[model samples]
Target: MSRTKSERYFFLDDADREAVQAKGRAHNRLGLVVHLTSLRYPGRFIPDPRQVPTEIVAYLAE
Candidate 1:
């Protein structure tokens, strides 16, 4: 099972969490994809499908 943003980044500071929540409200799918991919590739840009992992693509399809 995949962990939620809060579960995955339990140590996030208040400002970071608020920023993430703001992004969540603006880009739901993108947020999930970014969060999942960031676990493996931190500080990397994920602007589109070509940048994301195959596994993340499959998960997004569902």
Candidate 2:
């Protein structure tokens, strides 16, 4: 079976949280996804192809 990516969230500072909420309330909406990337790998054999960057795929594997 295949594994999927998982995410962890960190809360913003009180002021930033308030500002985000205020903007959402005023606009009657929320903004786009502003987030970070976290990756996990499998046991010995298989590599996570998603985590590999385009520029140096072979070098990374070697």
Candidate 3:
């Protein structure tokens, strides 16, 4: 994991934290690791397989 920090709130995979490392590699950014306790609507949380962030998505495609 990259040693960067910030105050922005974002979500990531709980199981594969490698995504976090990947995110860091993409932008070299990081912050307080606040774990989400619950999801208000699980449906809204589902990721769209067709659309993904450009940087990390490229890695997934490979």
Candidate 4:
């Protein structure tokens, strides 16, 4: 995933913060968002989020 797509799909806005926070763990939070967004864009879970682009992860982390 690119930074652009990550921002467009995986970017967790304030509205998503509460739900993501409820996940209660760093990996879970990221994984949830990644899984959700993946279903929207590339239309699949990408198998392993760790393989996600560094730029995408960095942008979503913001």
Candidate 5:
């Protein structure tokens, strides 16, 4: 039997979540999320939001 891929969970805790929310505006929020997720994952910081993955951008947008 083939093994399935693992699920990735991007859960931001209360204090951290508030800090992220405090960044101000959708533009700034997206930027900070990109910076944070880049370090959490195996990728580098994306310079453009248009270039960031749809999955990542959607998750952060929530």
Candidate 6:
């Protein structure tokens, strides 16, 4: 008979969970465009608006 591998799960402690929640709330207040981009590119946050292409910004505006 073959043995099945067990799965592991990890969880955040109360303090860590609270800290993450607070950070998420602050990020949400930055506006929809910011929130969307952050979700799309997890590594990048608050990229400079001036450096972004005008066409992209216009698209996001709509």
Q: Rank the candidates by lDDT, best first.
A: 4, 5, 1, 6, 3, 2
Tens-place lDDT digits, model 5, residues 1-62: 11111114344567767888888888887778677766665566656657766666666677
lDDT of 6 by residue, 26-59 (tens): 4342344544454454445546646544544443
Report the C-alpha displacement of residue 39, candidate 1, in angstroms.
10
Residue runs of model 6 more than 4 Å from their true location after superposition = 1-31, 38-43
Clashes of 4: 0
lDDT of candidate 4 over 1-62, digit per residue (tens): 55566677776667778888888689778778777767877788889777777776666666
lDDT of 3 at 17: 53
The best candidate by TM-score is 4
Backbone collisions counted per model: 0, 0, 0, 0, 0, 0
lDDT of each: 0.50, 0.29, 0.31, 0.74, 0.63, 0.41
TM-score of each: 0.29, 0.26, 0.20, 0.69, 0.64, 0.34
Over all chains combined, what TM-score does candidate 3 have?
0.20
- Cα deviation of 31, candidate 2, in Å: 2.4
Q: Per-residue CA lDDT of candidate 3, range 32-58, in tens?
A: 112121122122333443333343333
**Model 2 reaches what TM-score against the true structure?**
0.26
lDDT for predicted candidate 4 compared with the true structure: 0.74
Best candidate, lDDT:
4
Q: How many Å off is the CA of 34 in candidate 5?
A: 1.6
Off by over 4 Å in 3: 1-44, 47-51
